[model samples]
Target: MKLSILDQSPIPYGKTAEESLSASIELAKMADTLGYKRYWIAEHHDMSGLACPAPDIMLSRIGAETENIRIGAGAVLLLHYRPYNIAERYNMLAVLYPDRVDLGIGRAPGGSAEATIALSGNFLENVSKMPETLDELLSFFEGNFPKDHMYSAINPSPVPKVSPEPWLLGTSEKSGILAAEKGIPYAFGHFMSEQDGPEIVKRYHANTKSGKSLVAVSVICAETTKEAEELALSSQLWKIQQAKGEGKKGVPTVEEARAYNFSDEKKNDKIIAGNSGVVKQELEVLQEKYQTDEFMIVTITHSFEARRKSYELIAKAFGL
Candidate 1:
């Protein structure tokens, strides 16, 4: 099985954005040396908790810092930027990093409504143009557009010897169908929504030509199951804040979570947490259910060191 990291650069309760970003770079280097497959950064705008608003810039810095593991945007909110610009930036990254670039795209706004407007001037218009934007992005990679197409007259450049591998990141059947139609890799954001992951993976494999499937999930690993559960309270509290639209700044500490008094049902609904053995068991079950060999972990905790150790434990568990 292959393991990857999808870092949102979550700003812990006391850490600054600079510290969070530095942690991301350090984590990328760690993953590279630990024999992991990929280190993908997320793009989230106007979220004080998420330090990475520009994944392209982070990818460039991470690419410079890592040697082997692929560096990429976990999901660049494609609707916010021009297709040609997106194409050029990623292709330029490919030029800098060669075959070690993965370009994952998503249609989500990646921010609040007002921030979305600030990003693209018109969120709805950009959302409506997503399909065409995606097509134009792919055309830049293919270096050709249909003769009658308006983009046929222009080509996005410094096309690398190998284009960055494109993956559609989504949580539903629509995303599966689109990725299948496009014939690229597909990633299911199991951590972002309550959608049925096994079904999504099943449908994606059933429809895709390449049969590539990736699941991004929330995982917290510790030395013991009890310790893991305790650490996970913070994530639960963070989710509660997000649900209430109050968690836009930073991830809360474990103490904050304990004080929040989240419902037991809500705490049990998500978060795969335990010791290495238990985490491995849960992941193995997921692998069997999805019939895939890859899993991308998204871990957010109060302490940077704990977050780093979580990945380390998971990597050790998986023998990655």
Candidate 2:
């Protein structure tokens, strides 16, 4: 099983965007050295704390800084951009990195109205037709939309097509069907949706048509479960605000995470936050129950020391 890394450039309370990006770069380098399979950064626009509004650009910077590490946007919010443009942009990245690049796609706007409007401009009209819009985008990437079959107006590129693997990500069952029907790989966001990991993975794997199917989950690792949970909350708070569309409550003071509320314990355990021994049992169970071939982890601890521990423990646990 292959494991990957996903970071959305979470803005720690009181830190600047530059700080978040710099930290992501550092983490990317660490993951590469530690034998993590891939390092994918997410794209979020106009969030007070998120620094990855343009993941393509950031992935380029990250790819330049690391070697032999698969670097790509954890996802491009395909809803917000034209398919041809996305195809070309990611295609260029693929050219630079060859098979080392991947293109993760999600249906979410990756932001709210004001931010979407600001970032997408006239393209905002394209939002209402999400499934169709995604179809158009994929048409460009696949170079086979067959405009004659439809009355819509879309021009796809025949040259420099994006050959990178496309990973469809979502929090709902509908996304599973969409990914399966389209013959694309799918990833369940267990971190955001608070769903059962084994069930989601099983559903996707059972229904997947032809592409490689994978599951990505979130976790915080430490010598003990308590420390993992504590660090995870701190890491997730920075993410929740960015994702839940709330304005920042200002930079987080060091102690604020202690006071914040995330989901209950039943919810947190899916991330499998614990020591090496405990997490291994969890992963083996997940693999068997989910019948999965590939698994990715979004480790939530952001401290340099904690992040390293998270990767090391998982690798050791998996005997990788």
Candidate 3:
């Protein structure tokens, strides 16, 4: 099985945004050396806990620091930006990193309602125009606009020898259908969605000519299952606080998480916490169900060391 990383660059309670971003670069380098398939950074706006707002910028720095692993935006929140702008930015990264760049597009707002408006007015309208926008974006990458098309006269600058691989990232069957129709790779956000992932992925494979798919999962691994669960408390509490519209600060410490009076209903089933062996076994089960060999693992913890160790343990378990 192939393992990859989806880094949100979470800012722990006491850590600064700078620290969280630096940790992302370090993690990317580590993943490169550990033989992971890719290192993807997420884009989030006006989210205090998540540091990254422009994954394209982070990818440039990470590309300079890493050697072989593919670097990309886990999802660039395509609703906010123009197709030409995104194409130029990632195309530049492809020029710099050659075949090691990926452009994972997503339609979610990726921020608060106010932030969404701040980034791009009429987000709902943009969502409705996604199909046409995606077609234009791919046209920019492939330089395949129709002969009489208005955009045929222009192209994204500094196109690389190999255009960055494009993958549609989403949590629903709608996204799967879009990706299949576009004939690009699909990445199912299993970590965030409550939808039927296996069915979505199966449909994507059956319809897509590309036949490429992966599942991005939330995971936390440690030397022991107890330690992993303890480390996960911070993320669990953060999600609870977020749903209640109170999570403006960075991720809370384990001590703070333990002290919080979480109701029995305030549980996050998305996080998979366990030792290396247990995580591997569960991932294997997911791989079989999803019928994909690649899994993008996203792990966030209060301590940077714990987050790093989680990836290391998983890598060792998979012998990557």
Best by lDDT: 3
Q: Tell me the number of clashing residue pairs for each predicted model.
A: 1, 4, 0
Q: Report the Cα lDDT for candidate 3.
A: 0.93
**lDDT tens digits, residue span 1-320, model 2:** 67778887766656677877888898888878778788889887766666788989988888888888888777898877767788778878877777788888886777767777776665556656767877766776666756575623544333343377788888777788778877788877766675665676667767865756667777667788777777776655655554555537433432676786555423344567777777777777777866876677876554656766888778767666
Order the candidates by lDDT, highest first — what do you get? 3, 1, 2
Return the lDDT, model 2, position 9: 76
Q: How close is every model to the real structure, measured as TM-score? A: 0.96, 0.84, 0.98
* Candidate order (TM-score): 3, 1, 2
Give the per-residue lDDT of model 1 (tens digit) for 1-320.
Answer: 99999999999888899999999899999999999899999999888789989999999999998899998998999988888999989999999999999999999998888999888888888878877788889988897887888888776678789999999999988888889888889999887777788887888788866769889989999999998888998888887788878887689988887777555436645689999999999999988888888999999898988988999999998887
Which residue pairs in model 2 clash with each other? Answer: 13-251, 13-252, 14-251, 14-252
In model 2, the worst 10-residue window by lDDT is 151-160
* Candidate 2 total steric clashes: 4
In model 3, the runs with Cα more than 4 Å from the true position are: none
2 versus 3: better lDDT goes to: 3
lDDT of each: 0.88, 0.72, 0.93
Cα deviation in Å at residue 200, candidate 3? 0.5
Q: What range of 10 consecutive residues in model 3 has the weakest lDDT sum? A: 260-269
Model 1, backbone clash pairs (residues 3+ apart or across chains), number: 1
